[model samples]
Target: MTLNRRNFLGAGAAVAASLSAPMVLGAGKPRVVVIGGGAGGATAARYIAKGSKGAIDVTLVEPSRTYYTCFFSNLYIGGFRELSSIAHSYGKLASDYGINVVHDWAIGIDRDAKTVSLAGGAKLPYDRLVLSPGIDFVDGAVPGWDVSSQNKMPHAYKAGSQTELLKAQVEAMPEGGTFAMVAPPNPFRCPPGPYERVSMIAHVLKEKNPTAKIIVADPKPKFSKMGLFQEGWANHYDGMIDWIGQDFGGDVVEVNADEMTVSIDGEVTKVDACNVIPAMKAGKICEMASITEGNWAPVIGHTMQSRIDENIHVLGDACAQGDMPKSGFSANSQAKVAAMAIRGALTGSKVFPAKFSNTCWSLIDTDDGVKVGATYEATDEKIAKVDGFISQTGESGDLRKQTFEESVGWYAGITSDMFG
Candidate 1:
């Protein structure tokens, strides 16, 4: 199907013009169901509820009351920001935005009937559905690593209890104990995230336990912000960080959580702490809804609508957007495009193609930051990047602090756009 996305959700009278004040129509107005309330789903719900006015009945099914964005979560883990600052409620979207936010999980979707079945066993029928369920880990992809073992080895990728548990483990480890990080392969959420997290943890180790060491076992040979991370480690930790890339027999295949060791190249390295960020796939809702094939759900990019089923739209880290990394910033930007597409799909209006942009920042030390950003456009089939995307090249006093300032400003703005 042909798709388009317009960033212009017109201001002022646009709402008044879209439909009369509190317009009423059972058939003409569509029942739109949005699943998940992370970066993508929440933004989609707010915009669709605002722009549609009383024209559409919008209900968002999300499991959590508050969202902690993965975009800047590392800052919180590193002690640079408070958890309260990272956590946000859906009060804005629920109260001011005029959307019904349901506290529940979407267990199944009937594409033929165009309805969503919740875990509570209620059948909520819909004219169209928007799903941005984020991601779920594939079972048994990593040998000796299963859901049961995850409690001992926290992935901390989802950002919440697991994150807290992981952080507490790192904090409680014996002084000079080894902190091992099992990095996932590429095409995972936040490509630079694992390394940046390691950098921050190393920072923690340096001030508290100078002899503490960090061992990162990677399945990939190289990573994002390599030079900057190396430089920071050299200056700050005295090379206390040891990275074993896949080239250096560091391709981890299995783990023994009870033993606190991970196997790489037929060898096991015991450690006091382990943060194994395994591979990811579309969230459970997608699997229940049958919208996913393997790790991702396929979608038409211009509109962020599902390619398999036109009435359903998918966005964020869960959707198969080839060009963008699975970052919260990417999800937030894509939500705008998805919202417009949902509006058009409901009203039968002409859809406009979309362009997207995202910037991800990682802090290495106090007042020191690194960033990677990109520009993108949506084609009829997939999301692809435009030229000129760049990353922080080197460590300097000015550039580092400047990026920190920018990171702070970004949190302020995006949170405002999302929850403010």
Candidate 2:
């Protein structure tokens, strides 16, 4: 079957009409169903199908045909990249890897029956299910703000239309206007994301509207690479960035979207633009599956398999995998391990012990970047970080530039690793 966007949708509709019960395994090739098609899901689908060598049937379910990554999205906001540069197509995963790419929403999972119900009414049976639905905002986490108020104060965390919307809003800011940011709490998708976003916005304002102000009301006292980011902001964007930590009313923030105002410790400040990143939890499908222990699915680290159901493996930001930060690199790393284990279980392939690694890089300005990374090995309990390195606060200009270049190369490499 030729798998293009239009053809795939037509075939999916036909399949949905016929699908009734779960296909029993052990009668034919083992089937694998992957939900969500970003870093974790896309990479897991590609690797499992490729490694299984036609021994396992792979079906990847995602709603969008094109995916935009959240990793380098700050660069897009910083005016360092174009929207097309961050967007990726799933055509290769379907045509090149012999995987069934179904563009539809996965509504529910019947774990006991080993079948997944789709929004399109299809039931896909799987010997093993890979759920990487990513993060969803926690309801009521931000007062006076909800998805409906997103147009007024964008989150831009999902890195597609919201990202574009935020960018356009930032560009449209009036001269010398105030831009406010309400960052998330702990255990969000990326540890450095909010700070990196602040830097990117500072970069844009520095060039476009130098007199404008950027106010950050953060719930946390400190953030990832705090020293480096603080240093960079001091050196590069002094007097323009006002960061309010938890100690100074940053933790107690309320927003009036209708009035375009933010209240920090009851001191209301009117702003021209706002970006609110609320607390997040595992995507809704995780709850639908009844596999989630709390907000996140608990997974056995060695194999990325659900501690609740061995037949299912949860990867990326949606899983509570110890010591692994929720980032694109961590998700892609976890995907390979899950892929290998699934192949071994289904196709009788050799599976090695899981090893994971991640490096989070943030660009402070043009050719100014810093990074923190670690290599990890799975223990009996969790994935534990082994050796790690972080960019020094007083690093040389040359070294910082080199780090930025490395991040550029990494963005190219990891996106290819995920999509292709």
Best-fitting candidate, scored by lDDT = 2
TM-score of 2: 0.93
Candidate 2 whole-model C-alpha lDDT, 0 to 1: 0.91
lDDT of 1 by residue, 132-241 (tens): 88888877767787778778888889888777787788888898898988888777888889988897788778887778888888888888878878777777677789
lDDT of 1 at 122: 85
The residue-level lDDT of candidate 1 at 288 comes to 75
- Worst window of 10 by summed lDDT in candidate 2: 1-10
Per-model CA lDDT versus the true structure: 0.80, 0.91
TM-score of each: 0.91, 0.93
Best by the TM-score measure: 2
Candidate 1, which segments miss by more than 4 Å at Cα? 1-27, 348-350
